[model samples]
Target: MAADGTFSPVPTGEKSPEGAIGPRSNTGQKGGAGALIDYCTVVLPESSIEDHGVTWLPNLIGQLFGTNGAIVVGSIRNKPWQFYSQSAVLLDREGEMVGRVGLGGNGSTICVSLSGAGCRWVTRWDNVAKAVERWRGKLSRVDVAYDDYDGECLDVHALRERAAQGDFASGGRPPMHRFLSDEGHGTGCTLYVGAKGHKELCVYEKGKQLGLKTSPWVRAEVRMYGKHTALPLDVLTRPLDYLRGAYSVLQEIITGFCTRIRTTRKAVEATGTAMVEWMHRQVGPAINLLREAFGASWADFAEVHIAREGHPGRFRGVAKGDRLAQLMREELCPS
Candidate 1:
């Protein structure tokens, strides 16, 4: 709350679209720089107007952010958020809003959110973290985003394929996912894993998002909710590690592939990520019913029917040899 027994406020950024770890890795090696702390929301520990003054809100921000650039640009008359009801926008050297504060009366919880640019501009995270530590602030949410330039790691298509193959599944089942494309509208594409309020991940074309029609830059982001999990301030210092910990697939950075190993695989039917969906809808039920009715003899009839059929109608024409092998190669894309 403000010193005058009023309130303070945050910037107006879009909240996560409603609808929407594997391990603890200490590998601070290469590529951590690629991850960006695009968004952050922290709730200040219990506070009162008596301890600090009406100006205490800004003063607290100044101490945590190490600057007096907080312009009390908001009040109850112009609340930035619906809950906090009052706010102040924290400006940087460039007068850009690096962060915003949400405050109400004494004992009312205060909230603060830093934007993508704000996260990059804040260089004193470690020092300010100490101040927050003393106050015992709690992180409500944080988004760790990584840009895979030209899909150096993996693109949206790869993510969709992998999810279909259950590569992103940490628990036994893969999370729900949806793919949205501009369909040549020039807006770009996006892949969403899981949903809101749950562990969610969004992988999209960053360059295309910026209007680069042909740019291949893909960005992957993981949003963490501290409502149930304990979020440490170290997430700010090592966002990349946290991101990798979100999905085991993300940790497998594709550096490239060796031609020798690529050509040495055994000759088997070319099945890709789509194989799972097809099997579930087509093969699984039929086999289950056959087994239920015929018992051990189900295989005799089912396998005989499948073998006699030779190949499914869809694969009747994309027969073996180089043409069929090419289909397999495409599915094993390095990207």
Candidate 2:
């Protein structure tokens, strides 16, 4: 979108002051005019539904009555609204439930579901409830309660700390008494989700060690735990993060000159004219995907950090007292 070709500082005076600010104009193409790409956005509570509507919302007025954004929007339409799972909670190494600021809906749910499914599938959570109960009893006999924590409210830094402690080798594994059915009897239960130790073959780096060990029950060496969690080896985050970061950086760099060329209408006109062309050449693929996959919600990913120009970070940060934190407590973690 073209920014209104004005770079005046927002006036602070209660009343309009004459010539309070200098005239500055920076113009670029007013509308996006480039090939579309598919992209996925990590939903955040603060993420604007209106912005997402641009790409996903059904068009009330149009010839086809729909566009690529609508189709892409439909893909993730059934995503759960809660940020955290009411039934499940994550624990860090210290055994103190990690605190986060967001809900466990969207990406977090997917990650948990996938992790649980990947680790234990055929067993099924519903069926496994009995097993979990049995295990809890065994562990309780040993004086342990099944630990619970949620991912939605934790900050990335906090998650990192917890992850470091949760690993089996790093002294992070939950107490045997907490997770096992019977430490002495070993008859009550075991960590059975569905299929135990299914390795996600999509992303595995043979050389780089992600720094964690896996269960002996795991068949193939390529497991998805430790560093291989959700982060893809080649791509980072959801793939959208890299593209968005690059786009934002490039946009900033290009717009930085807007101030210099504000007075030069010709330059403004030239840049505006080239904007579409530049975007097409550089970010067209990612943008198109973002629109297709996530629609206007792409903005939610705008602030996501990119470790490399091409890779996106898997985690989003939550500070101490953000609304997301409150939501996590109210919905996922009750005091």
lDDT of 1 by residue, 289-327 (tens): 989999989989976676562333333222344644565
Candidate 2's TM-score: 0.16
RMSD of each: 21.5, 26.7
Write down the lDDT that model 1 would get. Answer: 0.57
Q: Estimate each model's TM-score.
A: 0.59, 0.16
Compare the candidates by TM-score and give the number of the best one.
Answer: 1
What does candidate 2's lDDT look like per residue over 1-335, in tens digits? 01332111122231212221211211121101110011111122213322334222223111111122211112223233434433222222222222111233543322112121111111122222232232221100000010111112212233223324542121223312122233333122233111112211111111111111111111001112222122221111111111112212111211111111111222222223334445687888877787688778775665463222421111111112243234334433346
Q: Supply candidate 1's per-residue lDDT for 104.
A: 70
Worst lDDT 10-window in candidate 1:
14-23
- Clash tally, candidates in order: 10, 32
